[model samples]
Target: MTTTDLLNVRSLSFAYERRRIVDLWSERFDAGLVWLRGPNGVGKSTRLKLLAGALAPQYGSATLNGKVDLLTDPLAWRREVAWVSAEPPPFEHLSPAELFGFLAGLYPRADRARWELHIEGFGLAPFLRQPLRQLSTGTQHKAALAAALALGTTVLLLDEPLNALDEASLVHWRACMAQAAASPDRLMLVVSHEELGVTPTRELILKP
Candidate 1:
């Protein structure tokens, strides 16, 4: 690992219904974009959730910046990470604006101005005032992304974020990812089935 490597996972394991999904998983991520590539059942999403501190590991730990470990300092680890799940935000009754407002309060580093910039960049302004339930799946996904992007976290985990974007939105978001990848202090991990539109710094493919 290089000096820039900040995110580390060691001997990680997790299961569901007594069935193993990730077993003996260990990896270290340095600054830049790393695409977690794999087939549908390869547990890419599960790994992201583990790295994001959204799910507890049955054994092992994820540490960030050498100072925060998922098991020993979960809240700090979570604060240093931002995640965009494959699913849309679940607050059906909240408009994008309302959702951002709530999330901003939760993340002390959230930038409202940055969120607005992402909204404009993704062409999501027209749907900002509409409730999430009223938006298309793609639009809702964009809304979720805007919020996450503005969180200013050191590690950004994205699960199939390009799933339902239109051509224009896709282009802008790709640019956004590329820009973020240029940062020397951040690690951006994207889980995707396709790599056509992204210039990943490196890739880790999980075999089923």
Candidate 2:
């Protein structure tokens, strides 16, 4: 395994009540941009959840950094990976800055400058003070993405990152993703139906 290889899976299999999803999979995910594209209900989110340690596989095994089991140490595992979903979770009364600050507290070494930069980059500066419940879907998504990106983890698992964004915001998101992908220590796994705009180093399609 190379230094760039971050995730290693062997004979991985996952199923829901005997209905197989991921089957006999063995793959090495290196530090780079990887796109997982497939039709709806084809297990894209399921595969990502497994990789992110949100779900345990029924069979086989996966190791992060060669030895750590995601299931055994989920919090520690999450420190190495970040998940960004298409549907922004209900933020309710929390302000964007407040929410960001809360997430920042999780990482003592988090870069404040980078966090502010993302806030501004996403055009979320104006709405920072407004309650997240008051923001539009696109703005809410931006805030969520900003918070996740600010965590500065090694792996980013994004599901339909472009959803609900306008054309200009989409452009900005593409640029942001491109910069994240440029880091040799960073690995981005995106699940999307539309063209990702940025060129991915590898593409994997799940079949039903």
Candidate 3:
């Protein structure tokens, strides 16, 4: 396996309060955009959380770069993988500019220049100085997305990425994902309910 074979989940099991969600799930993730599709109650979000190491697996293992464990190697795992959810963590008091500066410190190797480009492309400059709570839902979402895109991680896990964007922004974001996936060293796993016009390298459907 090469760098493209960065994420591997083997015999993974996850349960929520004794209710099994993912059982004995195993798969190898390769570079490129992989659309993770499934019906509403099939644990798509849960699976992404497991893969992102936001939630620990009840059993089995998830490996990053073929060696780093998602459970025991959190810090190392986060450095190479970026997770973006539909509703991002609250930053009500912080402006987009302020929030980006704060989060950028965590990823030392993140591309500041590219981050700026995302901000411009997403048309977030107008609201960049306003508090997040004051911005529209779509603007706030774009701010969060800008941070994730700026991270320059090897693996990107995006949940409902097209949630609140306007038509123009939607087109721009699709281009962004497409451009990022063009790199052979990067892997973008996205969970979307509708087609956003960008073609996925592959699609994996999880049936309940």
Candidate 4:
């Protein structure tokens, strides 16, 4: 693995009842935008989950920053990585402001003003005071994206990031992703079948 690589997966494999889901054996990943593309049920999201330390690999191992085992230090590992999925978190009776506030507390140095700026940038300002459950799907997705960015983690794992976004919103998201990928210290991994406007530094195509 390169000294600058933030994540490394060696001989990594996982399966469900003898069916291999992810067989991405021996791959060294560095800091940049990596697009993991494959058809449905091909383990695209599963691989991202493993990288984010949200799921344990059935075989081989995953190492972060050369020393830390993601499974052993999930909390510490999560501090360095952020995962965003198509489905926004369930917010039943909680308002957007309340939900953002709760998530911000997880990061000791999270700036509330900065988070608000993102919300506004995403055109979520109008719904800030409304309950998250009542917001439209696109609005909810926007909120989730803002919350994930606010964490300021080094690694970002996004699954179907453009799910509910309109054409204009998709263009804006692509630009935002490009800007974020400009930082050499930060790595963004996207798992999507759709054509994202942003270009990836690396592309990993999964095969059955």
Candidate 5:
């Protein structure tokens, strides 16, 4: 493929209940925004999870930066990646401030100021100190988005990021995504059912 550092997946396969979801799939993800679009049950989320090293592949391998095998060097791969899932943070009892601090610890190089900036941009300041459970789904999603983006990782993975955003927030997040995509060194992988309001550099569409 292109002479760039790529997220390389080869002969990748996975299944649930003996039913195949992704079957011997292979692709290369390079820098800039790449939208993974597909209908429900097409394994878009599963592929994202596998790419983020959140789920172990049933077979085959995925490599990042040419040599970092996600299956073998998961922690190393994660160190350079940031993932935002469709679901909110699991620690509903934790406030956004606490959760952000925890994430900053994991990503020692995280930009806390940028995180706070996004928090404010997303109108999450009032909810920052509130427990995640007390925040609305959209607000909680904002918290996750802020933390993930603030990490400033090389690889950013998002699953259904636009699902719970308000119209204003959605526009703002789309701008943010565009800005992030402007960077040639950062790779953005997003799984969405609708247009993100920004053109993706590439797209991969799966099927049932």
Candidate 6:
């Protein structure tokens, strides 16, 4: 991946309850798997959320391809970004199948075929009929991941992705990540305690 397809952040700062979480951080990440390595409470997930446009940073400017600015062109910027949270879905009624259908209608570039494949690849086909509350934590994460991966976005923010994956599902994800790492224009920031397999283009270690 080249610097032309970079995920660049400058003057990055964030605070919670008047306590500084991210303080004047600045980094340029080239397109590839970026291992977001840090100790717990270091704001790794918060940084991802900031980039995903879920949480606005107290200070900073971010750009994709040096063209799409997060602050100025947020709608266009969000089209190229996808976030996969480690936490299970908060809602209780919707199933993975229902979630996929809803997302397919929601996103303009939704890939229904890819979602079908992911459902089987993640071993979630059998649980498609089950409600979110009926599924296990791992299964819920799988559903969220499947939706995110199929969105065909350039920026993928994966928080603790390898957690709760079974042996076969883990293998599937490893292969998928390896393929993603080889992409020339895609950026993946994986927040994890363990390095699953693929090599990271860079390690972003955050300090509180």
How do all models score by TM-score? 0.95, 0.89, 0.94, 0.89, 0.94, 0.92
Q: What's the CA error at residue 165 for candidate 4, in Å?
A: 0.7
Per-residue lDDT tens digits for candidate 4, residues 1-208, read: 5364578778777787888887856777787788888777878887887777767788777677676667677777777787887567656477778877887777665667878777767888888888878989888888888787777777888999988887766766887778766767778888888887888888889876
Please list the residue runs of candidate 4 whose C-alpha ends up more than 4 Å from where it truly belongs after superposition.
Answer: none
Write one digit per residue (lDDT tens) for candidate 6, span 50-70. 888988888887999889999
Q: Over the stretch 1-208, how does candidate 3's per-residue lDDT look in tens digits?
A: 4353668888899999999999999999878888899999898888888887788898988887777887778888878888887675466799988887887787767787888898988988888799998888888889988888888788888999999889878878999878866767788899998884778888899988
The better-scoring model by lDDT among 1 and 5 is 1
lDDT of 5 by residue, 94-184 (tens): 9988888888888867998999889878888888889999989999999999888898787889999898899878877998888866767
Which of the predicted structures, 5 or 6, would earn the higher lDDT when compared with the native? 5
TM-score computed on alpha carbons, candidate 3: 0.94
- Compare the candidates by lDDT and give the number of the best one: 1
User: Where in model 6 is the C-alpha error above 4 Å?
Assistant: 1-3
The predicted structure with the larger lDDT, 3 or 4, is: 3
- Candidate 2 overall lDDT versus native: 0.80
Q: How far in Å is the alpha carbon of 116 misplaced in model 1?
A: 0.9
| Global lDDT of each candidate | 0.88, 0.80, 0.84, 0.77, 0.85, 0.84
Cα lDDT of model 6 overall?
Answer: 0.84
Model 3 score (lDDT)? 0.84
Clashes of 6: 0
lDDT of 1 by residue, 62-98 (tens): 7888888889987888788989899878788999899
Which runs of model 2 end up more than 4 angstroms from their true locations? 1-4
Candidate 3 lowest-lDDT run of ten = 1-10
Best TM-score goes to which candidate? 1
lDDT for 97 (candidate 5)? 88
Error of 3 at 94 (Å): 1.7
Better of 2 and 5 by lDDT: 5
Model 2, 205: alpha-carbon shift in Å? 1.7
